[model samples]
Target: MATAAVAGALGLLWDWLWSERFWLPHNVSWADLERPGVGNFPRARHVLSAFPLAAGIFSVRLLFERFIAKPCAIHLGIQESVPHQAQPNAILEKVYTSITKCPDGKRLEGLSKQLDWDVRKIQGWFRHRRNQDKPPTLTKFCESMWRFTFYLCIFCYGIRFLWSSPWFWDTRQCWHNYPYQDFLIMFVHHLATIGLITFSYINNMVRVGTLVMCLHDSSDFLLEAAKLANYAKYQRLCDTLFVVFSVIFVITRLGIYPFWVLNTTLFESWEIIGPYSSWWLFNGLLLVLQVLHIVWSYLIAQIACKALVRGKVSKDDRSDVESSSEEEDVPTGNKKCPYDGSSSNGANQVNGHMRNNCWAEE
Candidate 1:
């Protein structure tokens, strides 16, 4: 929290300088929060607009995924992984759960001696044990669908808001009257703005919140799109989006939000109104957001490293890959595998072995 607070503060500081928050409201105080304003549309009324907007995009994405992406995935030969026969051995499972997941050489050696099996078989068993943890295909589909909808909805909403609002586009209007000296609060500010928009819409702060959401949501489309593309087996397209997403993420999230928008919020708002208990709450929430971004940045760096050195794009590099060995079995080059086109009633007999092996029957 301390670290996050510092990060938020620094982010706001950057925003303050860039936004020129120092030049407004020479002697702003808490009393100013209640100062009546006129001419602004009831921000609360517009808050409800987000739900319908999100729903519309969600519908479109679902339709597209079902009709387009699923077919595309099938055409490109990417289907669900072949499920391994589940072992219901309670004692063996208990050993796997209580002890190290991947046993060390000595432990493996001991286990092999006890089980009267080779070390390789023990390793393969452990691999299958871990494989049991793989999520169901439906679960992955739903998760990806949720992300796809959220990203698409947020991106479209952001654009709609930007198009409707002249205040954001007109630079001459901003900092026309302000005072400043601030740290970055861009990340948490958006989160709080969204909360406030949903909860305290009457506060008339929802417009600011909307703008914050817009700025941040800018890069998210590419991130989710890349993952969806990967799932659809659009590997080349996914690779391109992954690269673009990284650049956009750095530009929008790491660069502009903290330096530009946070400046507007932190330094500008403080001068307009004095500190309240809610101020503390708001800042604290913002700090939490900054911490999350920093954490995700670590994962993003890993992705970048893999892209640079390994020359491949990964959707979820943050988590350990299920089985690097299994993944590696697909080969390292741009070499594509030809799908064995055996119909439902038939099996592809490749090199005298049935290629469409079903281990689940075991």
Candidate 2:
């Protein structure tokens, strides 16, 4: 207990020093209440304020899905065919853990020779072993549904709210707000979004910006819906939705977005706002978004080609595998985590373990 106390104190002190001295800009420390006064929040940490509302909404949605959506899905025969999942024994588990946790491209052929198994079997074990980290089908459903609901509502709200603003008529109002948000990658995405909205509003670029946001939101809605369908075992429906998603994503992101949005922000904005450093920052971030769009588009195309050939998609490539929503905007993350088969009794055990990565990879 005494050791723990000392360790805790040291850890806290290190955190304080690190955050205050190294993390903050100009070594600013949290030393004040920031002139507590009228129209300002109290000088107390109250980050909990937004959490409850979000929690309540989540709870209600979960409850509704439990009592409503899940039952409907079950009745309609929408279900995943869960084969008996297997767990690796300690020694084998250790091997898998080391490989996945910090892979160093150790030869699977050598591992296969060591285990007295085919290279394909070794590869299969590792693939499914890593897949074990994927989120379950139900969690994926709820997440996709939540995002679909949010983007749909936000798109509608953005349209309604911006219709009457002066920025709708003029191109210079967006410069007035000059909102500068500094955030990490995830928060940078949100900042970029707010930047897009604010600048579009300021520079009378709303006409193009609003359309881009709507197009993005629309594709997002379909993407999430497709994931929900995928989880529900509605392969046909999932395929249909994915096809539409691919089509719209291509049309909007590749065609309309690059042309319309880039023209307005990069070309037209320069004409109105004139040249500035921030313009480069703004357009640079926009290009970052475009790069992401193109990368995801490649995945979409990858799947589309498979669909054309096989009439359906049965698996995904590792490159597109997601561990969390931080890597993507729509309903994407780990899919169903598969595992290895159990060994048979005694001497024949190792020989009888399942030995195939049956799913085709292109």
Q: What TM-score, computed on C-alpha atoms, does each candidate reach?
A: 0.58, 0.55
* Model 1 lDDT per residue over 1-362, tens place: 99999999999887764331232233543234334662223332455555665677568767777776566555656565655643565545767898737577888788778878777666656656766676544334444545556556656766765575654764223333321211122222233234433432333344455555666566655665666565555667766777776676557656776666666556665655544444455545555555555655555555655555655564332212444456445533542321212111000011011111110000
Model 2 segments more than 4 A misplaced: 1-68, 78-88, 101-132, 163-212, 316-362
**Which runs of model 1 end up more than 4 angstroms from their true locations?**
1-72, 105-110, 136-142, 170-204, 291-295, 298-302, 314-362
lDDT of each: 0.50, 0.50
Could you tell me which 10 consecutive residues in candidate 2 have the lowest summed lDDT?
353-362
Error of 2 at 172 (Å): 6.9
lDDT of 2 by residue, 1-362 (tens): 99999999999997864353332223223342233442222221232333565566678778866776666556656554332232464645777667573223366556666678655445455555555665555544555566666656665665565566554345344433222211121121222234444333332233445445545655666666766676666777877877787787778768877876676667755665465544565577678778867866676666665555767645322211433333234321353432211111111121111011000000
